[model samples]
Target: MLKVCHMTSVHKRYDGRILKKECVSLVNAGYDVTLIVTDNKEDEIYRGVKITSIDFHPKNRLDRILNSKKRMLKKALNIDADVYHFHDPELIPVGIILHNKGKKVIYDSHEDFVQDIKEKVWIPNCIRIVLSFLFKYYEKISAKNFDMIITVTPHIVDKFLNYHRNVHMITNYPVVNFEDRKNNKRSDCNQICFTGLISPLWEHENIIKALNIMKKDDISYTLAGPSDEDYIKKLKDLDVNKRIKYMGVVDAIGVDIIQTHSVAGMAILKYSQTVGGKIGTLGNTKIFEYMYSQIPVICSDFVLWKEIIDKWKCGICVNPNDIDSISKAITFLKNNKLEAKTMGENGRRAVIQEYNWETQEKKLLALYAQIAGERVL
Candidate 1:
């Protein structure tokens, strides 16, 4: 069996994309996979993938770049696997080092780092510009050394293609299994749901503020997944009649429950074209999850995202920043339950037919095949 080592300095060991999808898929495909992550601990096996660690969690952003990089690199070198896959922008140098040791290094680009840096609110305006330029150059220079580049969306692929030829577009689509949820009908549910990174990048506040605009006592909102402690406090202080409830960090089944119970899903990424802003147009996994759960969606009005929503006819794409648009969409979905139900079914059908992880699985295995010399590179 080919030994594969996946590394991450940021996300936890069982992160959805790294563990649930990629590592698990590799194991099913007959590769011996091991994931290297932070938190120095003994290695163990979870779902046939070995999990190892560096036992390091930095206090701040600066520590991750200034300190965690070296320690994680040392752990990676000690693993000595045939193929090294790393996630995290700061690990670009780590990937290069492994590549120099003659290992097939694959860089997983999940986000546009340069864009993210451009939108970082904490960084000084002058410094943010400098950091964005430095990171843009560094990302390109480091990515060119990798054997292959695995990207989560076409947008990221477009960015990476300018740097490297071997770019694989493997989206972070949900594990499309809607058979069990087919018979589970929920017609009049008034709950709206959102799970995943509940941060400013995801426009968490936008979702809450939209709900605030629609003063419907009957409607309730459920949010799961971890967010900053300070942000959590801020949301708690919102006088939204205690209708907005945060369920804290939830597991896979927990997230599914929220989606199933919700009448409509919220995926309102903030509309921003600034340098470090979040890529609002990429594949938002939560939308697909809501579809798989058979529900209408209220998402941002980005051109790429609107096109998908229009093609599927499953939800309303609104100006996320426009309180009236979001409020109107939700109010419509709540009042016109039948229309919302139809939209939900259309979304589920779309997920079952095309936007499923199983389809992306083929792309992933094909990339590994090329790596293993089982197919032409």
Candidate 2:
């Protein structure tokens, strides 16, 4: 029997986008898999898969790095597996160690680490630059050593094409057959929704400002996600509390419900150096979720997003930084419900026909087969 070990340093649980679906697919394919992740305190079996959580504080910067490195390296050394699959960049050193031990390793690049570092405000610019450079250099070196490198985007794959021979793009798409009941219901109120980590990159301030400008009493904005106290305070100070509701961190099912009740979804990310690269990238699960829920989307007016919105007629594109533009987009969607509904339906159709988990999973399985030197199933 083939055995695979998967590692993640920062995930709250083993069951998230890439890891969860990948684990389920691999287990169904007759692979014996063991996932080593940061313990979220509640331990349980998920579809006959074994998950071993190592105690680590993901919030504590130094502890997260050190503990993840120690735990992953030790676990990789002890596990008798055919392949070692690593998800987090913090586990690169551990992957290197596992490679030296003659174990086949897979490095899954979830994002462009070099570009991502620029968004981190805690790290000094100089430090971020040095670390980004080091990360790229080591990533290239590590890719050569690993059996295969898996990435979420084709652009990311392009970055590695010159450096690595075995690079594949397995996008993060949502499972096709989720609860479809909510899609049929339209809320009486014109509610605009945004669901994601409440970070500076998300640009929630503009959304709040837009709400203040629109002054449309029938419409209210719901910002769902856990946020830092300072950021939350800033949101409160916007004087749109009556128009804005803060529904702290909703899980997958909860997010589905939220999206169902809203008129449209917002992916209004600021075009900072760090976020510019991520703005128009397709295959983000949220985009599919919004589409699947049959709600139009008001996204940042990036070239990439314009292509998608124009191609699918799924939603409107607006300047994320401009409060008036965002407010106008929301107002337009509200005033023209029929058009918005059509855009949403078109998006859902696109997702069902081309961009869902079923399509992406095949890429993943094929990539693994190629790495294992087996014929494509």
Highest-lDDT candidate: 1
TM-score of 2: 0.92
Candidate RMSDs in Å, in order, are 2.6, 2.6
What lDDT, from 0 to 1, does candidate 2 have? Answer: 0.77
TM-score of each: 0.91, 0.92
**Residue ranges of candidate 1 with Cα displaced over 4 Å:** 178-181, 215-218, 240-242, 273-279, 374-377
In the range 153-237, model 2's lDDT, one tens digit per residue, is 6667778898988888887777777445435557364798988777776777888888887755858888798789888777788
What clash pairs does model 1 have? 39-55, 39-56, 40-54, 40-55, 115-276, 118-275, 118-276, 119-276
